[model samples]
Target: MKLLSVNLGTARPVPFTDHPDGVTGIDKRPADGPVRVAAPGPKGTGGSGLAGDTVCDLRHHGGADQAVYAFAREDLDAWERELGRPLANGCFGENLTTDGLDVSGALIGERWRVGSEVVLEVTSGRIPCRTFQGHLGEPGWVKRFTRKGVTGAYLRVIAPGAVQAGDPIEIVHRPGHGVTAATQFRAVTTERELLPGLLAAGDALHPEALAAARKHVARYGG
Candidate 1:
């Protein structure tokens, strides 16, 4: 697989966002040169891992587990066919637009070596929220997206380094688990019964997701 483009965004007022500030960093555009990728901190404290990218809502966005968001070009094309509109590389607010990658099918904890140095692990799937629905301005978008169940993967930076457009993505590691990003998305969203099963992913599960799964197991005896 290859990185089609490295995108970054700046904070700006979004007309329909859920944030009190009415601001969002969803307007990502491809950037030139190698961008530094590192853990920004925790979920509520850090923003995007890409140095110049902005994360507007600290309470709901950004953190070590969600340092980078990636989406496949093929998925975007699918959306475009359904929406009857063209979607650009970074249009979905993803930091990395990848080509020839089955991002949603990737197993949790799978590690990708980007360029020559940066390594990132699959953590979870991007959950559709009010901000995302509002950004799209499509009626029933959240429900539509949820039903599609092809949510892109959120990545945690493992080895900080520089990443650029056209970088090759090598799968250097894959956890011995069947819990894929799509599975995690369903578990947390529509398929509550599947939550406990995500524990099989172990530490590869995002902290918030792990907590949710544990809570489900405690309540439902999974």
Candidate 2:
């Protein structure tokens, strides 16, 4: 697989966000040059991992575990066909738009070496929120997206470096667990019974999902 485009966003005013600043970085565009990739510290404090990209709602985004977000270009094409509109490379607020990658189905904790430098690990799936729903302006978008369960993968930068469009992606590691970004999304959002099974992924799973699974097993007996 290869990187179709490396996208970055600038903070802009939005009417739908709960942030005190009322700004968001949901509108991303393909960058013209190579972008620096690094861990952005932790959640609620750090911002986007890609240099020059904005992450307005730090409380909910931009952290070491969620350093980068990736979505498949094919998925965007599918959405374009379904929505009957042109969706650009970074329309979904993703940093890396990939070609020929099964982003949604990628196993949790899978590691990908991008451009022979940066290494990123699959952490979790993007959970649709009010900001996303408002950004799209589609009625019942959150519910629709959850039901569709094609939520893209959030990545944690393992080895920082420069990444650009046309960079080749190599799958370097797979945890061999059956839990994928799509499967985790479904377990957390729709089917609670599957939460306990997500433990198979162990710490490679997102902290929030890991906690949910533990709670499910503790409360319901897995």
Candidate 3:
């Protein structure tokens, strides 16, 4: 797999965003040169791992578990066909726009070495939210996206370094568990019965998702 483009965004006003200041960083553009990738902080306090990227919402977005969002160009193409419109790289607010990568099919604990230094772990699937639905201005987008279950993936920075466009992506680790990004999305969103199965992924899961899965097991005995 390859990193098609490295994208970054700044804070600006977005008309349909829920944030008082408006949603900005969602509109990422491709950038040249090496971009530093590091853990911002804790789950709720951190922004993008990429140095120049901004995370507008702390409570709902950004953190170690979601330091970087990745979406495949192939997935965007699929969405384009349904929406009948062009979707640009970084348009989904992802830091890395990847090519030849089955992001949704990635195992929850999978690790990727980007370029030569940066290592990122797959944590969870991106959850559709109001901000995302609003940004696209597509009616019933939340329901549509949820039904499609191709929510891309959230990643935690395991090794900090520089990443740039056209960098090669190397799979460093793959968990034996069968919990893929799409599987996790289904477990959390529609198939609550599958939550307990996610435990097989162990520490590879995002902390919050791990907690939620445990809670589901406790409450529902899944």
Best by lDDT: 1
For residues 61-92, what per-residue lDDT tens digits would candidate 1 score against the true structure?
Answer: 89999999999999999999999999998988
Q: What is the Cα-based lDDT of residue 217 in candidate 1? A: 92
Clashing pairs in 1: 42-63, 43-63
Query: How many pairs in model 1 have backbone atoms within 3 A of each other, for residues 3 or more apart or on separate chains, i.e. clashes?
Result: 2
**Global lDDT of model 2:** 0.93
TM-score of each: 0.98, 0.98, 0.96
The CA lDDT of each predicted structure is 0.94, 0.93, 0.90
Over all chains combined, what TM-score does candidate 2 have?
A: 0.98
lDDT score, candidate 1, position 128: 87
Q: In model 1, what lDDT does residue 113 have?
A: 98
Of the pair 2 and 3, which is ahead by lDDT? 2
- Per-model RMSD to reference: 0.8, 0.7, 1.1
User: Ten consecutive residues with minimal summed lDDT in candidate 3?
Assistant: 16-25
Cα lDDT of model 2 by residue, 89-177, tens digit: 99899999999999999999999999979999998899999998898888998998899999999999899999999999999998867
Q: What is the lDDT of residue 34 in candidate 2?
A: 95
